[model samples]
Target: MEKPLILVTNDDGITAPGIRALIKVMNKLGTVCVVAPDSPQSGMGHAITVNDTLYCDAVVVDKDAPQKEYRCSGTPVDCVKLAVNEILGRKPDLCVSGINHGSNSSINVLYSGTMSAAVEAGTQGIPSIGFSLLDYSLEADFEPVLEHVEILAKQCLEHGLPTGVVLNVNFPKVSKEGIKGIKVCRQADAHWVERFDKRVNPLGREYYWLSGDFVNNDKGEDTDEWALANDYISVVPVQFDMTAYQALNQLNNWNFSQ
Candidate 1:
């Protein structure tokens, strides 16, 4: 059997340690091709380059690595689009994004370029997964999560994800032994309490820096937030469909003819 072709990408740019570590694991599983942002695009969500020209160039970030890599000057979603539409000659068997520097759990998925890349691939009928670590540091250790990453990716390849669904996997910042297990769970009903730090620049211009505290009010033990808090890796299946099916019947009862 031919080795499965795997497409790997991330929002943290091509040379990020997170991605480099991911490539190492992927190379062991199958043929790997990386198409990622040329620079950090952390909270870009599913944005595409519409107003500006896009560029994707072949590059050798690690000459020793076997995978062919491209550095794209666009959002994370743009990388997947280019990979699928232009780069790869055939549809990839699997698409994996991130090993991101921070968490993409719960509501953060709405603002994450990492998860958005996976969501983009999922929309194209590819089995996709977005992996994130709870630590937000540039030098955060990803060793503990590598085993779980391999396991999940292998499982995805073995048993394809449901139509239009992608996986959002988040790992706690713990040692390999500290990890309890993996939990397939739902997104926690949580949100950020935000504030803007208004300040003046050296030229006396006003500026605002966005900041916030994460508040989890949902006490459900089956949520992604709860799983991470208890040292288990959380895997939430996300779908691209945004329709509210329950609201259809309720709105149909309204008197629109009057």
Candidate 2:
């Protein structure tokens, strides 16, 4: 049987440990092609490199497997677009982003380059999944989630996803044993309570650092937040369509035609 062609990418840049770990896992499953950002683009949400000139270079990052590697000077979404449109000779069977250094659960998914990359691929009708770890440390151990990645990625390959949907998979910052199991869940209704600390720089210039604490207001046990808190991997099926369908009839009854 032919191996699956997998497109691997990340927001944490090509050289980051996160993407490297992801590449290692993907290499086990199929023929892997990596086209990721040249530098970190973490908070960029589904952004493409339209305003600036984009550059993609074929590089020998891993001498053993030299040909399928590329580095791009664009957001994670651009990496996918470039790989599908310009780089790869064929469209990939699957697109996987991240093994992100930080979480993309709940509200963070909206701003995550990791999730955005998967969402971009989802929009292109490719089967996609985004993997994230709760640990934000540069040296965080990704070994724990690797097997889980294989499990989920293999499932996506075997079963395929529904139209317009991609998986948002997040792991807790726990040891492999601590991870009870993978839980399929809905996105938690949560938000960041933000505060900006205003300060003066060395040259007497004012600067502000954005900081916030994540607040989960939903008490639902089936939410992503609850799953993570309970030491389970959370898999939220996300879609690009942002329609508020429940409000359609309510607004129609408002008599806008009058």
Estimate TM-scores for all models.
0.98, 0.97
| Count of clashing residue pairs in every prediction | 0, 0
Residue-level lDDT of model 1, residues 9-63, one tens digit each, is 9999888889999999999899999999999999999999999999999999887
Determine which window of 10 residues in candidate 2 has minimal summed lDDT. Answer: 59-68
Query: Candidate 2: where are CA atoms >4 Å away?
Result: 255-258
lDDT of 2 by residue, 1-258 (tens): 999999999999998898888888889999999999999998999888888999999886878862389999999999999999998877899999998999999999999999999999999999999999999988999998899999999999999999999999999999988999989999999999999999999999999999989999999999999999999999999998999999998888786675
Error of 2 at 84 (Å): 0.4
Local distance difference test, each candidate = 0.96, 0.93
